[model samples]
Target: MSAAAARRGAEVVLGLCAFTHDSAAALLVDGHLVGFVEEERLNGVKHTNSYPANAIAWLLDQAGLAREDVTTVAYNFAGRHYLRPLLHVPAHLVDRLTQTRAIPRARSFVTVHHRYRARMAQVRSQFPKAYLQSVLHHRAHALYAFLSSGYDEAAVLVVDSLGEIQSTTTWHANPTLQLLHAINDPASLGYAYGAITEHLGWRRGDEEGTVMALAAIGDPARFRPLMSRAIRLTRDGFALDPALLPLRVLSSRYGRVTSAFTAATCPPRRPDAQVESVHADLAAALQERTEQVMLHLAYRARGTSGSGLLCLGGGVAMNCVAVGRILQEGYFDEVHMPPAPADSGTAIGAAAAVWSDTTGRAPGGLTQRSYLGPAYPGVILSTAPRPGLSARRLTEPARELARNLAEGQIIGLFTGPVEAGPRALGNRSILASPLTDDVVKRLNATVKFREPFRPFAPVVLADKAADYFALNQLSPYMSIAVPATTLSQTVLPAVVHANGRARVQTVTQEQHPFLAELLAAFAELTGHPVLINTSLNIKGKPIAGTPELALDCLTESGLDGLLLEGWWVTRC
Candidate 1:
């Protein structure tokens, strides 16, 4: 999409991954992730499921552009054709038909359903002057991984619940690329994982990551055997045991599970319910099994394609544990996973796929960085700067903020470009004194209104990470789960999960010097080189982006301080 726009004289290409999970939009004037986010921060629904009209409008308004300036509209789902099948058939029928020999035909039937016509009409009506094209689902997934991976050649594995034609596919690519293999029939590893997630009493699509975290604390013994029985591996790849596991029950429409499944496992937990050891263990089983299947497929693809690098997409790619495992195991010499692995990222992927198909040019190189979304350029409103607040150099401001935090203040830190994925990486984050567990308890109960057991993550200085964690790599994406030392664990207990693993983000000077210095200043004061970092928001809403939003949160929230540049405001 960025290339096409660039070719057509577009000075800036904005890629919006909006209106799906997390409701965020990205701006790429050329070909970059200038902005990306989920609407949940703004809308307050856990996974806000509506178009990010607000985010879209906000980005354009901030960029000082008008709607007419957008030359083309490259939608991720190529119209309603992508989702038509889910409407008519029963979940069981969809599952059964998917496994049949005529699966391709059924897919076409679904993709070309009445919604396709309606979507086309809607497109014409909505963007009459803009060019419109529909890219297949998995193709988009492949593009997201390949483009962002920064590799010249690699094997791309796109796995997710069903797309236009298939669930999981393997694409072998160099500067030139080819679709090597596809698995459309017999369900997918993505679907299998989702099924197990639902059976374990978590919400299917939105709660899968939570299950992955829950896995680390659980025992997968009994559940692992059952999951293996339910999802059996075939001579070709993997298959579901339809007798034991009915794929239909896993559909979004399934809503709540049947009494039989819940009765067998345990009563399902509400989305906001407390996490139990049993649920944790079930999550563990599911995650372990998922890693097992992925490793098997990676090995197979590596041998078949003789490709050194692997590009991963689809919803399953969101499993950071699996990605980290793939990297740690050296399954492929180099494995790349896009920041946005879910359906929203498919928009950028679809654009890449369409561009490659039309021009026959392989994706040049991976995206150098993930600042591909929209950003606020310090719009100093005419209304007034909040009392005793002024934009200053990030250096001293960051240090002062750190000093306050070391003295036991919960600081709301918003600076630089916002993050793309689930983790709040310094730009749009809240920093607190990790030395005190009170921050966690108070924030969850008073501000976040979520489960108390859920833990905050650590933003540690890259150089000082060894003092706190035993890991070696930079966790800028907060993907891995590693243990904190016994001493560090005792002091920063709130950020550590039940199993003692911290989703630690290592801050380097290049990434954000301000945050890095803040960590240093914090260490100087308290001898702890990390701060408790959490998404800057209350429960059920997207993180606030604008100053008005920030100020409103400060007034309404139970926060201790606010830090935007040098301007720091404290409450009580």
Candidate 2:
């Protein structure tokens, strides 16, 4: 998507991520993503979840472009126009008032106009000369998912925390995408999932995925009955009983979630901090129920729309386990999951939506690749030369890079255009042997400085993916999980999460030959084509934007070596 943006002659493209965790805006010019970063990195806060004004200014400065120079200002969501009236109603009449507020009457008219006026004012203040446009939040997700997908036509499913009022939506996309059926109501799968996240004593923005991960470790049977009663599954959608799981209950239930809220009750849990069997059971129940709901939607959409390809967006789509389950059902011929399966990717979506909608382009194409962030070369690495730089590049050296990885040496694999999405796809990644369980501890302690519970992902040779995992399809975005094959289970056990599955990135010669070659090389040495590929960042920072940043990170983290654009920076 960045490549396309850059190719389209957008000298200064500002991608805005607002009102959420790690909110940020990126700037791209002349097909080059000039400065890309998350706001959290600048704030030194984990999930520093907020709007991206600071990040936007940084990007503008980084590109030497003023706000007026920006051609367009694209926001992920329209201001919450439809909900303004509901916001003012009394607590007792909340639902009924909110329902009426949706009617778009003269009273409701204020909500829409006020929202548009306020958002436009904000945009105008930021970019007085640029055209201001608001893309529906899910549309942004769908746009990025389909545009990057490289599909001609596919079923686009968007499931996110919430976009204004929408939680889930299904779009039947042709070359030009169009909305089909959307679960725009606030009582959505994402909200239901969020409600569970609150119940589990987790932070809303930062801890939901953890709950998803924890879900796999527990049994769903014990709590299914209770959960089923709490969550009523409708034919086309699902509803949550506000009585048991109020949206605001989290603020009251957990100390971490305290904030402004109304009357809401939270069911108490056992006192154990360690993930108890009950916690696991509840997580499993949520996972199971959510997966079922998603599958139901997918099958229905596919059957009704007569489309075999599926493109999934939204935060909920980040559940690789759920994605894998969907794939195993064999309802869709192919599925594409954008790497940044969250709101952050909405920047790409916003841009793509503008391009496609304006140009009336078609859909159903797979994304070119991720390599969307900023880039740096001589500026960073040339300043220093360390040891381990003696190895020369060869014409067909896939076997060699693979050999080096198997030799217990950390290799910084910086290949072509850096990936646009969150997951590093060989272009801007730190590669290591997933077989080494100790590597996880070492990398996290020294390089990542993140929670150990967050599992590492793998980028494997596409052809070899089936041999190693339960699936044979290409998952370039690292969004789906497949059980490890016996060979992979033994060869790369550490990368496999406790659930015996891996969030896999399948590399092909077409998609990334150099990476595939490196994998092949590693396979030659280690007898495995898999390498632990993680975003190249150092604790609470955006992935390296320049060669200098990479070198600095490499040196500080005790990495074995750094393979850059053309130069190799090794440890001293």
Candidate 3:
């Protein structure tokens, strides 16, 4: 293993994460993953969880190696918590100048363990000292959900909204990733659904899944006794119960979500403010008490690892409606989340735990597509020259992109790679014309400008997804959530939702044969093989990673055609 490390080939590693938020970067070579990004999709900045120095220089220029041919960077999380608050100034001037709370909880646990362990040794001297390493915050989200779950043995939860001090952990991962439970920080079901998405005014850790998709438009028995007094369970996971906080707890009791997400409104609308009905019944009792504490933390990680196969991830398994009520309560026969199940796929589980501890093998596993990031390298079908744009070249490019989305238009597509988390499975994506609801209020106010109660995701055709969503399995990463049938709520009315549910994804031509031949040519010309698709980024950006930011989000969106990789354009 030497001739200069075998001419610097496999055994690379570089997982990373930034100061906090969603900052990210990942790359692995011998342990496999390759590349992953998200410093707000190359700095258009939507979730700059800070410090992904432009996703670690685009993951060392997409691994063409040269940061001294990598030495093991890992990083996941290490903003050390001696109850952080930038190591509180004399514990917030002894709690607002002697207003009690004993010397700010013993000088915030004695001067934050030597100034947050020298600020995690200056975050490992910002790496590049031959694999600097750090990796622990939910064990890099349980090694990116057990190395992206190809499950040889499962049951790996993670949960999120607080890591470097725990916020629910659980593992058994037969890739040898055992732990059983953790919980710490001021108890959390991701901050008790981010303190009910910051007491319904919104913006609590990226709008707690837009309050779990606006709690399917309200009525969880009117906040059922404040979501059963905000989390406390503990048979092996559950805790955000600061005496069931009803409100006025502004900032840090144990953790105050890294300074209130700058008002996180995702469809959290608010311009001239309105929304009520107890803010959709406290977003339907905080998405039904966060799926009754994630099905009692998935039946206590399937009864302390009896493993029916689980594989979740932190950031509360990106609540695809509590992963569609834990795949309709079939207490796991198979689950697997990964499409960057938050904390930016824990930088591919901190470089797959130093390439499975210096290579013993553990690379590829996640089947059903996940692009891995960055693509659209020209040559997509071809034609566009640009002058006043209108370059066609369709000897049936998915039948003229399904007749420009059945003539309602919208398009965008982009093509190949560029899907490293936060759903957009149709390579880059945008599409539209999922029948109507006025192309879902013109893709939510002129192309993802956001709100009209944020929603749009269909992308069907994994064998017509059980005739339009109602538990048709194999959800190629639109995470989960089902229901929507009864004829996909009147023919895919812009990817359903007001209780008739939707958030689906499917699509399989072994994951992406040109988005399954463009949803089989839009189900052979509009018999509706589903499209809406979403996530070509804009309303808070991330998805479009280039092709000139997918032609500047199709020139400030309202799209009407663009298809980069396949080289088409429109507009005149």
Candidate 4:
């Protein structure tokens, strides 16, 4: 390697994903991730597509580096895909002229395209001294998953609504990643799920999880015949009918659905309307179809690559139910997904991809422990003062918190670093004893302000994971849902969902010391090592990223107390 190449390998590398949903920034030094955070966490937006300026600044400040010190800046989106919007211009004009507006307006696409270009230019101007490279969107997703899997070789699968032009892609990564098969736009499982989410009166992209939760209570057989016509599974892949599931209309939220679909199914539910049986049944059908397509792709990936391990990426991998089904099918011996398998993870992928290209070697050393964001260390009460809150330092933090939980007090936990992904593994979470019969109701109605039907997840000791859930593999990231053992269903009623499954996060002392200690203590007192673990944020907001935000959430919500670092805080 040349002198400059050696220096680049030793110096700082920045990764970013901007101008799209789940914008984020990540930093890698010597091919090891040092910092990663989502723009939504810093900006207080749920899933903002705006440029991640705040995230970039925070990562730089946290690393104690200036823009000039960065050797390379890797972007997660490819500029070559910008012209894709132009292809929809004719259809957009026709939609407007005909007054049907079944297709998204061309202006929306053009505006987004221009905005993306302008943001890219701004990024370039901001990092003039750094080498800038744009990694393909799906390629970045694949790299993140494959590298993080710690697998020498695996069958990689990337699935989302649309990454540039491709929607679903399969790869063979025998240490070196290579694309084997791809299914491009208009036939995406992600978009199909999103469209159904919107039709069920939920926000697309943001509220697909809600739809997934609702599926547990509905019967898929009610709408199976209709969905069968809308989405057809092929020998190798799947196809979506443009007439019923028009791709053009799905590009924007303002786009209209075809009258035929509305006639065949029920009318779209109003946002505030009560979710009816019909809506629930439709969600069930959509969830089932999504899983079917995912399995089909998984089988294809395994057949093509002949790899025993599978590494899944992209937004579709965030569907834990489908991921669990993939695992249960036994097509692949092992399956791995990063904590943030969605677009946020692409930031790390972008940096890793560029790092590998520059060093002529794969970027390694990423772990499943996702506590990669900023860490705040200090006296919480002295540094951040709140008018209506009182704090006291604890002698034994974990034991005290376990006792509090055993007493049925819901506690907000803010410790160490903020997690990178959406699920709060343990550091920033709401803790409650799952043995409480009314705990789920209290969490949903009083604390989280979400639909009561949405179930909470459980955090258990890693060694005791199989005792509670029928999980054959570790779920450190809460990435999959598995069937709850009979003991868990009866003992930890609050965390088990209606479908008899739970999204369980297993914690080892090596992965999360404090959480493991707390679980052990709780088990000593309550005879079960499980606790209801959910993000420390209210409805329609991002997870709390700072001590101040955690305190604010505690004051606003019905949380009994907050464990901030070594201090215990409570409302005055």
lDDT by residue (330-446, candidate 4, tens digit) is 999989999889999999999999988888787655756488886788744752358877888899999999999999999999998889888998888999999987998899999
Best by lDDT: 4
What digit string (tens of lDDT, one per residue) describes model 2 on residues 1-572?
34344335554456677655657675545434454456654454445556667678766766666676787777777765445435534542447523332333324335445655675686678778677677888988887787777787899888876676677888877867778887645456776677667667665555667788888678888778766755677888676654444432112322321121112223434333555667677778888888888888888778767899999998888777888988989999888887676877787667556545555543222256465444554433443455533333344445555666776767776655455555677777888898775888877777777656667888888888888888868888788888888877787777788788888988888878788777777777667788899877776565665565666667677578777776556643
* lDDT of candidates 1 onward, in order: 0.65, 0.68, 0.71, 0.85
Please, what is the TM-score per model?
A: 0.82, 0.80, 0.35, 0.94
Model 2, which residues run further than 4 Å from truth?
1-15, 22-69, 84-119, 198-202, 248-273, 356-366, 380-401, 414-417, 441-454, 538-542, 546-561, 564-572
Off by over 4 Å in 4: 1-10, 84-112, 249-256
How many clashing residue pairs are found in candidate 2?
36
Q: Candidate 4 — worst ten consecutive residues by lDDT sum?
A: 96-105
Q: After the best TM-score superposition of candidate 3, give how far the Cα of residue 117 lies from its true spot, in angstroms.
A: 19
Ten residues in a row with the worst lDDT in model 1? 248-257
What's the CA RMSD of model 3 in angstroms? Answer: 20.2
Better of 2 and 4 by lDDT: 4
Candidate 1 lDDT over residue span 173-234, tens digit each = 67555788777633577766776677666667766776776777789895787668666766
Residues 1-572, model 3: lDDT tens digits: 23255246656777877666778887776666667878777778777766677666766666565666666777775544545533434543444422343345545544545654664566566653564767677888887777775767788988886775577888897768889877756466776677657656666777677777778878889657655755556656665543343221223674332222223222343534787776777678678878888888888888898888888888878888777888788898768788888888887887777777776666663433378777756554334445455666556677778877787888878777688788788878888777754888877888888758877778788877888787746878888877887888876767888877787888787778887887788777768778878788777677777776777787787787777766678776
